[model samples]
Target: MNIKTQLKNFYLLQCGQFVSQLGSKITSYGLILWTYDNSGSVLSIALLTICTLIPSILLSFLAGSISDKWDKKNIMIISDSIAAFFSLIVLILLITNSLKIEYIYIINFILGVVDAFQNPASEVAISLIISKENYIRVSGIRSLSNSCITIFYPILSTTIYAFAGLKLIIFIDLATFIFAVLTLIFLVKIPKRIYNTGDNTNILHQCKIGIKYIVNDKGILSLILFMAFVNLIASIYNCNLQPMILSRNGNNKFQLGIVTATIGIAGVIGSILVTIKKESKKKIPVILNIMMFSFSICNTLLGIGRNYYIWTIAVFLGNVLVPFLTANVEFIMRNKVPLEMQGVVFSARNTLQYISIPIGYLLGGVLADKVFEPNVYKISFLTNIVGSGKGAGIALIYIVIGIIGFLGCCIFKLNNDMRNLDN
Candidate 1:
């Protein structure tokens, strides 16, 4: 198909993804708030995170394989259905005041299992069917969808929580899931993936092969590893922001919502830039170097930023580079991996990428609540002589991590193995 036609097809599916993400976000914060209200334990929150993420890490390869072996459209539709049904049950229980945190945990675990399949299927389908000229648009669409979640979720949840209560918001989220499933059913028609004629790998073998490929391919694996490391730090900063703000100036839930909306707005702006001008001229190393630097700077600023406005600005600018990095990484993975192997490869990559999130959250929770909270005064560096407890110590840590990210850029400059592929 021509580029225009491909763009049209890909965007239709993206709309469904957009709806899916919106509801997912609404349900997400509600659950988090519920946990805090019920137990007031960070450990409960951590368990919730582990429950949600463990499936993504373990089933990623398998999910990828199934997506490749089956009809891509059907995979999306089925996954959506699974998610919708689970949300509906939770919604009903919530409305009746029978919902428990355990219920939320169970449903989240199920959703994570489906997510493992849905992610690789949708991403690979875009690269498979869309013309290369329009891949940027696909990337833009994905980024925009994610941005919407960050942007609207806080406001939506708070508004719902105010008058209607959390129960009603769960119902709204259920509706979002249904809309997503119906959109997929009526609109998308993905092609079935076929293995190469000579390939004899079983499902188990296919899973292992993806890991082997990621490991053996030094260039791809290094890029993936570095991406994971950056993500780890980013997640930590995100999770700790609320505590840091609270510790510094007495944080409120309402203000946190606004902060999230700002971050989302920034990401959407970044996606627009990518749509207008995707990566074209620079080598991969150059792109990675810029992305890592930008992320490092953003995180460092967010860590140490005293004023709310400064943190908002830092997050906003941080997002601009994020889409740039995200689009290029997807571009690289799609182009380098074989069609038959795309599912498994992308899954393996996502598995590694997501592994950073739990680790990040753990680190953030620990530092903000325990390590930094008690010893904020003791951990102070000579440079932290002027700043507050949360501000200075956290800022010092961010500076250290930021320097680590920049050093990654320097290391990339020295590596020549991936230069030819990038060019």
Candidate 2:
């Protein structure tokens, strides 16, 4: 099929996925609120993130190979179905008032496993359906959708939770999942799957193919390593962001909603810019530069700011640059990775790039609760710098993470291998 016709189908698929994504985000935000309200621990929230990441990291090798061998559409449909089933379980637990922190962790881990298979299939499906020239544009649209979700979910969830509670959010999530699955089955059309006869049947060998592909390419390997390091720093910042806002804001959901909305608005603006601009030649450098500025500016403000106003500005500016960074990265991946190997390679990419995230989540929580928060007052000078408050330790952490992230980007920019990815 022609690119235009394929794009029409892609848009229909996106619309379905968009609804699903929004519902998922709403559920996520509601859970965060529920978790924090009940536990009042940063560690609790960080553990939630770790639960999701660890399963994906552990199952990534197998998931990628399976995705490559299986039908992408079926994989997606099955994955979504499994996820919906788990959401139902969560709803049942909540209704029974039996949902506990441990249960949440288990549910999240299962969802992560589902995502491990689903994400690579979804990525491969997009690559198959969309032409190469439109990679960046499509990435922008994806980013735009995610940003829109980010902008609204906090507000929606907060309002919904206040009025109706978490049960209603889960209902919306289930409804969206149904819509997405139906759209995939009925409305969307993916190109026929083309199997590579040369592909080995051994699952182990198939999994190794992706690893070997990256390892053999020093430039791509270095790029992935750089991202891994960046994720480490980002994970810390992310794990703490909600806790910091809530702790410092007296657990005001509206403040959190407003700040989160600003981030989405910034992302929308950034996505628009990426969609309209011509692709750049120096993608690696662009990625590194954007990361450096984003971490430096956003983290700094977040650390220093005591109010939602500053938080809004910090996130807005930081997120505005994210779409450009992601667009360039996706553009490079599409140009460099062969379509037949994309599923595995992309999975390998995820495993390597996100491996540090679990560690970051764990460390961020420990440091916030055990180390920083406890010692914030003892270290009078440090407390003076960041100011004494409920989230003082987390504030210090943001500053440190931002600096490390900035320096890490700078160091990676000096790597010749990363620069050569453009060639």
Each candidate structure's TM-score, on Cα atoms with residue i matched to residue i, is 0.89, 0.98
What tens-digit string does per-residue lDDT give for candidate 1 at 156-270? 8866776677778768877777777777778766555454212565667788888898888888887787678777767666665554554455545676677778889988887
lDDT of 1 at 139: 78
* Candidate 2 residue lDDT tens string, 289-322: 8999999999999999989999999998888989
> Where does candidate 2 clash, by residue pair?
none
Clashing pairs in 1: none
Q: Residue 305: error of model 2 in Å?
A: 0.7
Model 2: lDDT of residue 307 = 93
Best by lDDT: 2
Query: Which residue runs of candidate 1 sit more than 4 Å off their true CA positions?
Result: 39-43, 193-200, 246-249, 379-400
TM-score of 1: 0.89
